[model samples]
Target: MKSHIAALLLATSAVFPALAQTLAVKTSAPERYVVKKGDTLWDISSLYLNSPWKWPALWQWNPQINNPHLIYPGDVLSLHYDSEGNPRLSLAKGVRRLSPQVRVVSDKNQAIPTLPLAVMEPFMRFEQAMGESDFDQLPMVLGSNFNYKMNIEGHLLYVKGDLPRGGNYGIYRKGDAYRDPDNGAILAYESILVGTGRVVRTGNIEAGKPSTVKIESVRREVKPSDVLMPISSGQSYSANFKMTQPVQAISGNIIASSNKLREFSTMAVVVIDLGRKDDLHEGNVLAIHRQSPTVIEKESGPSYIEDASSLDKVITQVSEWFGEENDEDSVVWHMPKEQVGELMLFKVYDNISYAMVTKTRQPVRVGDSVSSR
Candidate 1:
C-alpha cells in the first residue's frame, strides 16, 4: 500500500530529441488554427503531424510556447517552419477575436489538455488499483435510513464500524478482479465507485454499533454492504500533466482495460504491468505490439527458445501456426512482433500503471506488448 502511493510520484524524462528531428507537417494541415474550448493537444497534433504521439516534441521545437500543454482556448496558433524548414507552431497567447462593433474580454483558467479529458477524467478523479486485502477491510453500508433495499441520493445510509465524524466517503462495490494474463496471478481487485456520502452520526466499534451517513451524490444505485472509502481532500482530477519519453528500453503487458473489454481501440485507457519500478513516468510514449505468431517452417532444427525477460508478460502456447506439425523435416518459426498502436502513461503505481491509447492502426488487446517507441 505504501509502495503504491510512493510510486505515484514519478520523475519526467528529458524531451524526445530524436523524435523531434523527424517531425513533419501533414500536407493538409491548417495554416492557422484557433484553439477552441473542446480542443485537445492530440486532436490538434493529429491535424498537423502524421504521428499524434509526437505532439510533445513538436511543442519542444517552439521557444514561444514555454509550456507545451499551456495553450488556452483563446490562443491563436500558426503553422510555420523554422529557418531549417522544420515544422514549428507559433503561439499568440489569449488572443480574443473582436468585431468592429463590439469589444469584450474574459478571464479563463482552462488550458488545452494533452488528451481528451472526458475519456479519462473518471479514472483520474476516483478510480484506483488495489490488492485484495485493501478492499476487504473498508467499512460498508449496512442499510439506508428506513432499511430500504434501494440506496438512493439524499438518503441516510447506515455504515458498519465507527467512521471519522463529518468525513466524506465514496460508496463503492467490488468489481471483477484483474489477473495477469500470462500466469493468471490476481493483480488487483477493482472497487467500482458508485456515490459520495458523509458521516453525520458516529458509532462505537467496541459496542458493535453502525454509523449513519447521508448520501450527497449518487452515480449508480447503492445497496447494503457496499464499501465506503474515505475521500482525500487533495484528490486531483487534473488533465494538465507532463508527457515524456522513457530514456531506456522498456516493455510490459496490457493487463486490463475499462469494462473488462477484451479489445479496445484508440483513446481507450488501459492498465499495464510496467510502472515507476520500470522507470516509467507520465507523458512517456510507448508502442503497442500484437503478439507474434509461431509458424511451422521447413528449417534445420526446432526454433523455440524462451526469453527470460518477458517470461511473465508474454503468454506462450504450444501450438503450430501452420497446418504441418514439427517433425524432422520441419521446425517451428516465430514471426517478428508487429506494431499496432501507441499509448502514453498518465499515472504510475508500484507494479502497474494507467495509460491512454493515443493512436491505433489496429485494435489493442490484453497481453499486447508495450515498449519504448
Candidate 2:
C-alpha cells in the first residue's frame, strides 16, 4: 500500500508542473498612470504604447473607465496584480497616492474639446434622369474613328468613337454658334449663343475602331461635327447647410443639427451652404435639434390606420463639422454613415443651400423645412 501511494503522488506532481508553466505564461502585466484634465485615450496611447493602434488593448485592460475616449483632469489609473503577481490595468477615482519608486509625469499633450465626428455625415445625391436637352452635340475623336446616330426622339444624338491613346472627349450642344471641327474650337451656336449639355455617361475608350453609338434622348436639335469634351457635371442644389463654426446671432438665425438625422453611404456626399464666405471653417462644433412628435386628432369617425397615435421623436446630440467648399453653391460634408442625424442651422444661404434634414427616426424626407435655435 505505501509503494502504491508513492507512485500516485509522483504522477500528480508531474501533471502540476505542466499546468503551472501554462498559467505563468498566460498572465499579463499591469500599467498605471495619473489622468490629467484634457487627457484622451488617443493621447495616452500615443505617449506610452509603441503604436496608437494598441489603444483598444489598453481600453480592454481598463474596463472600469467609462467613456474611454473621454477623461477628466486628475484621475488615477492602477494596475491590478493577478494571483501569479501579473500586472493588469485598473481605473480609480480621486487623487492618486504615489509610492516613492513611481514617478508621475505632467502630460502637457491634452485633448482639445471639439465636436464629435458624428455630425459631418455623408449623404447621397441621387442623380436625376438626363433630359433630351442635356445630350451632347459635337462628336470628335483624336485618333480612332467614331459612329454616330440620333435617337428616335430627335432630342438625343449619340456618337460612337474610339479615343486616341490617352485622349478623352466631352459632349456639348451647339447653342447659337458653330464650332471649327479641325482646330477643336467653338465659333458660336446659332451665330451668337453658347451651348450646354449634361453628361449622361463617362468611361475610358480604348484605341481601336469605333463602336456603335446611340443617343438616349435630347432636348434640342443636334448637328454633325459638334464639339464633345469633359466638364464638371454641375453644382449641387442642396438646401442642407451644416454650420462648421459657431455664430453669435447678432441679427441672423442660429442653426443646430444632429448626426443621427443624416443618411450617409459609401459613395454619398453631403453639401452644406456654409463656408469661408459664411465665416465657417474647420474644428467647429454645433448642437442639433432633436426631432419632435406630431399628433393628429380625428375629427368625425375612425381613422384609416389602426394606431392613431402618431409616433414622434426629437433630434438631440451635438456633432463635429468637417468638409470643404463643394462649389459656388455649397460646401461638401463627409462623414461615416452611422453618425448622420437631424441638423438645425441658425442661418440660411441666399439663393443657395439650406440646412435640412435628410434622415430622421421617423419618415423625414427631402424638402422638409429646418430652422435654427
Best by lDDT: 1
lDDT of 1 by residue, 95-208 (tens): 557769644332257777888898878888788777878777888788887768887889999888799789989998888777767787877767788999999999887898
Over 119-236, each residue of candidate 2 has an lDDT whose tens digit, in order, gives 3221112211122243343344222123333223223333444323233223343332222323534322221112333323333446443432333333443445444543334533
For model 2, what is the error of residue 86's alpha carbon versus the real structure, in angstroms, after optimal superposition? 32
Q: All candidates: CA RMSD in angstroms?
A: 7.7, 24.4
Runs in model 1 with CA error above 4 Å?
1-17, 60-68, 93-107, 143-150, 217-221, 232-235, 298-325
Runs of candidate 2 exceeding 4 Å displacement: 1-144, 149-244, 249-268, 273-277, 282-364, 368-373
Clash totals for all candidate models? 2, 56
In candidate 2, how many Å is residue 150 off? 9.8
Which residue pairs collide in model 1, if any? 243-283, 244-283
**Alpha-carbon local distance difference test for all models:** 0.75, 0.33
Candidate No. with top TM-score: 1
TM-score for each of the candidates: 0.79, 0.24
